[model samples]
Target: MPTKTTVPEDHRDDARPQFVLEALREHRHFVMCAHEKPDGDVLGSGFALGLALKAMGKTVHYFLDDEVPRNLRFLPDADKTQRTFEGIDPSALYVFMDMSDRARADDALAAVPRAQIINIDHHLGNKRFGRWNYVLEAEAATGILVLNLIGGLRQTVTEDIATCLLTAIISDTGCFLYSNATPSTLRVAATLQDLGADKDVITEQLYQTRSFSGQKILGRVLDDFVLTDDGICYSTVSQKLLESFGASHEDLEDVVGALRAVDHCEVAALLKESPDGSYRLSLRSRGRVNVMEAARALGGGGHFRAAGATLAGPLADALDRMLTAVRAEMEAERARG
Candidate 1:
């Protein structure tokens, strides 16, 4: 077993920040990896860190397990990211940011050889899988911690870097509307704005620039939406629906958020069929439910308010089993009262 080191929220001051800074200084090259299905939080923060490393005159490789979502293609220098490792430097630093598990980094993660890994994330359920775990549950996104490293390195948070970090914060926090959004989060946003992060353009690009394909998929999801008497609203987007709408998997990304917006919904779920026939499940809570717990029970994990899991499917059957677990948890919560 790899020895795990954990940095709790309170102790995230100078010690762990220095560990990351020192690690970057000691290594000449780095292969930076983010979670599969690279969301804005992961990709934005990853790119921000890559730019910072390049600015310091260090060589950096941005690798992803999944292709960038069509919506986020406008992110800073996203074109440079590679799906394969062109050259492996055994000594090159492997830095996994914004994700909890190494497996989430990609299938290629297992093959990549690295002397050291610095795990940086904000998820409370993180396994402390790296040599250096600088995780702070208090942070809305890992990008906040990366900003700390930039400051400690005495590097500047240039306009581009600021924009990337700002997107990470907003994407993970639902534009700072989620419960995890704190006063500090707003402060970070304000600072990013003052640094010229262009909130108007970033928000427009992220939320408003939806494709017509995405719109049709969203419509299908909402039209078939179902809300149970217990306040659990559930739905599915089958492969057939996507095929008919000319939509891709990425278009279904925001559908769960739309489901959560339904009035009287305590928990909302969206399950989309994968090419392999497994269902990709996304769960969102209204703060009254711990959707993350449900996700973990189904072998997935995410934040308290938003969580996800993938399960073997015939979509309907998987939905039944998972919903049984979620409904039971809800019943238990009521029983406790």
Candidate 2:
């Protein structure tokens, strides 16, 4: 893929000037938000942007619909994030990072309807739901875009900002192992390191730290992994199983990836029981699958390799619908081959 300019296409019409810095300077009382069940990039990018804006003497609020994972608690200012939109004024400018669509922000999306929405994301399926959208399809992590936006403000990349950016880059790139990672991504990592991002601390806190309940849930999910079409693997955790383990949704975070790691598996599906009695479906794909399309068909969205959606029905019914879609896509790919 060819390298494209960082400037968004919508901004190209302006002959005089066009850049994120101009937009940032215009807005006050900013609210930074990320998607539900945020991973590293979502949390990291949001925090880094918030910190930078604060450094510039701008009032900023970071909002997330879900609780931050325990493992990511080490990120600077993680404790400062607001998980609810109770008292937030809708007049504040809303900047969404990592999430592709308004639905990903859940109830928080409605809290700031009239506010200027700036969509910053790397997901190919992004809906660009912002007054000023800066979607970078080639960037490995949304943090990279956050870094770019704060360009010339190199002095703003404080220890806190660097830590958050590093977390986002490492998590989104699978610790620099994913195909999306480029030489630029590595360079960004090095720069972040120089600014005081401790790789050992981040790795130890993120990958090495896991609750006992989380590990147990992962093991249980793996024990029941089922392979389909000799290439797809899947696992399901019922409400009963969760209750038996005294585990919440957070404990099952690693289950989907474990299923995807099975030998000969090109795709993995983890069907989890949500609190509302609906099924939350998470799908992961190897290089050969496009799980994002499958997730969108089910009224959810995410990246090509990792996507998710919710289904209001019995777990069995939802799993059947998901598998039917996956099987058809797999067959189509096979036919093309």
RMSD of 2: 4.2
Please report, in order, the local distance difference test score of every candidate based on alpha carbons: 0.82, 0.79
Runs off by more than 4 Å, candidate 2: 1-17, 83-91, 152-155
Candidate 1 regions exceeding 4 Å error are 1-15, 335-337
What's the lDDT for candidate 1?
Answer: 0.82
lDDT of 2: 0.79
Task: Return the top candidate by lDDT.
Answer: 1
For candidate 1, write residues 1-337 as lDDT tens digits: 1233443433334335666666776678987788878888888888889899999998898887677887677788788888787875667878888877887878878765433677889986777677666788789998999888888777899999999999999888877788778998999999999998989887887888888888888887899999998888889988888888888877777789999999999899999888789999999988777788888889999988889999899877898977976887677667877
Error of 2 at 135 (Å): 0.3
How would you encode candidate 2's per-residue C-alpha lDDT over 104-223 as one tens digit per residue? 775756756533777788888677667677778888998998898776344478888889999999998878876788998999999999999888888887777887878888888888
Best by TM-score: 1
